[model samples]
Target chain A: MKDRVTTPLGAVTLLLLLVAVGLGLSSPLDVNQGSLVRLMFVHVPTAWVSYLAYGGTGLFGLLYLITRKRRWDRLAMASGELGVLFTVATIVGGMLWAKPTWGTYWVWDARLTTTALSLVVYGGYLLIRAMIDDPERRARVSAVVGIVGTLYVPINYMAVEWWRGVHQTQTLKLLGKVRFDAAPIYGWVLLIATAAFTLLYIYLLRVRGIVAARDEAREERELMNDLQGDLNSLTPQGGLRG
Target chain B: MDKYAVYVIVVYVVTLLLLGAYLVWLAQRLRATRNEAGLTEQVRATSTPGNQTSSRQTPGKRG
Candidate 1:
């Protein structure tokens, strides 16, 4: 009954714009990375949101099985789809940054390889859902897959620490101390970008949910029609004659 | 400043373009699907006749 685009979605759009402006002005360009560092404003947020989105899918997948709610399944699927997009964005952005800094577009380093594997796992989840015709069965199997895929997130985070690799150490965290200077402008920018990306993710998930819900409704209608037609066929002929 | 500046800029620009295009595509698809569902619901409501009333009336028949 509510307008899908104008209410929650409008709020998200405004938040994203505010954050984008804050991030743009606050963070100084890295002395070494130069202007390329600005890309981090987008890249890091995408990566973070992708992780959050996928985690949400896993959580909803679990809840759906227990609650037996079709709505939860729909939400899980929508989140998974959005997660894949963000993951793709993260990978492409990382590769772009890598080429300039590491002198190669890709390497089989622990972090990159594990992250790629994570992407493949989620991609397989969608493929498996497509391969099944029954909605209930699809949700059950995909839920299992979603739970298993979550194990890779922690591995992806720790890949740099666990192995010697070409990937530079994480810049955002260090030995119980935040290294980056927390000047007001920089702090405000990061906060804004983070807020914006989070809203963008929510907006995307909502749109996808609406699309999925419509598809389900359409399927239900077709199924009902088919059942009715079958029933009509089975009914006795009007006349008693042969 | 660095030689790879061009590459970074190109990559960022391309990413923005791709994501922008995708969002637009999603919005269009959402509109189309909603429209299709609405039309289908209308058709079903009209074509189904008194089946709805019959179901409510025949609740005690318990097949």
Candidate 2:
């Protein structure tokens, strides 16, 4: 049978995801919010993963530029794309929950605005990559953008606490004192969701790497073919007919 | 399940659909890349005239 945990990294990630889901599902729902609070199981973890993925992209971007490794650039691009997806999910989930709780679909809160800004910055990073034609140049420019865009993740997270914002403060923080009774099953569900999403992320990253490798090989072949054609056309008759 | 049940269901469904679509796209891409890699290998093998004889003579070491 194929190894379910093929790599050490995969095994460790799977374990952590299982733990996270277990913790999330087992934790009882807040007495105030009822079962709807269970959405936090998916939302909070996805938001965390989104930041982690983007942060990873920034790091890989740095590695790509420093080492001039195409693999690093490919991984960075993949991470950023996944980050965008999770960010969208976070925003949508938050909005859906907010409409009922906050009585508004969206609020011009500091945290919300900053989070939105962070999304835009990363979106622009993708656009910059698309605009550049040369692979090396594109990688370099995107690396710079990726590194610069990461500054906003912290800002997005801390905006509510730092400023007067409509967004609520984080309850899962180490320093927070708010207490709420949570169900046991809630933690398990969260753990499961986190595991599933992390696995999905890993699977996508691997696939993206394969695609990038194929693209590089195709480009190299095309260049070689063009060069050969040019050389063939330049050669006169049989040999150098001066 | 109350008035807001529909909204919650809609959100879940939409998220699931998006995730499923992405997975399908990724699978298609993986298949395409594997196919391209196979084709490229085949072309490289056939394009080299000397390799053809060697490949036929030493089937064990071809790969």
Candidate 3:
């Protein structure tokens, strides 16, 4: 029996689904956007989670640099992978929403473009990890990329305001009088959706990080055994080196 | 269903599909890793002290 305990990720995922459907069906639609407002429940949460994932990747990468621990590297890589997936979701959801609202399936708005660039850069970060076989070197390189790639997250958020893009400003902003300007039910749905997605991200991070750590440990053991076998073969006698 | 309703449904559907697929992929990886660990444990058990030399000698006869 080796680490046979079940993970809570699936359980949390089921809960998220129930909450998502509940909100989707019951939340009030926007006056202008009509039923199309329902897309916000999924779109906004995915976008927020994508940013959270990149932020986690950067934070874990910094921790790895400070502590020189393989666990930190594993966490950073897991977050990066999740960030890429969430970004894809965000992009797809946005396009779907935009097609009906903006009358276009694609746009080159500042926010959209910057978000796409963020996806590409972070995606490169994952590719960097895959290209490097040496764990230590891979961690070092990915940590650098992870930290730098996260700079795009803030830029993506601010792109609309700074550059006068077609993509509207965030409904939820940190500064400027905490206002969502939507129905209270819409706000509640968005809040619950955000929490659910955030929980989902954290759960995935934990499970993915554990799996990554185990695989790395297993690989390390195999490598050590191979080295021992080689040493035994090269030795004058059939014994380990003193 | 309205056209906008269809768009919203598609978006949610795609989101669910992508995330669901990711979870499934992670589950598969975890299962495979567990199986590998179990196989490794069985191999270690079989190659106990008494059979270590014989197990090492027959490189082709792996568990």
Which model scores highest in DockQ? 3
Candidate order by lDDT, decreasing, is: 3, 1, 2
lDDT (tens digit, per residue) of candidate 3 on A50-116:
9999999999999999999989999999999999999999998898888877989788999889889
Off by over 4 Å in 3: A1-6, A236-242, B50-63
* Residue A185 lDDT, candidate 1, scale 0-100: 55
Best TM-score goes to which candidate?
3
Q: Which digits, one per residue and each the tens of the lDDT, describe model 1 over residues A66-157?
A: 99898888888888888888888888988888877888989999988988887898899888888988889988988888877877777787
Q: Which window of ten consecutive residues has the lowest lDDT sum in model 2 chain B?
A: B1-10
DockQ of 3: 0.63
For model 3 chain A, give the 10-residue run with minimal summed lDDT. Answer: A1-10
TM-score of chain A of each: 0.87, 0.78, 0.91
Error of 3 at B51 (Å): 4.7
lDDT of 2 by residue, B1-63 (tens): 345545555666565566567768877977887798889889788769776676466566757
Q: How does residue A126 of candidate 2 score in lDDT? A: 86
For the second chain, the TM-scores of the candidates in order are: 0.56, 0.65, 0.71
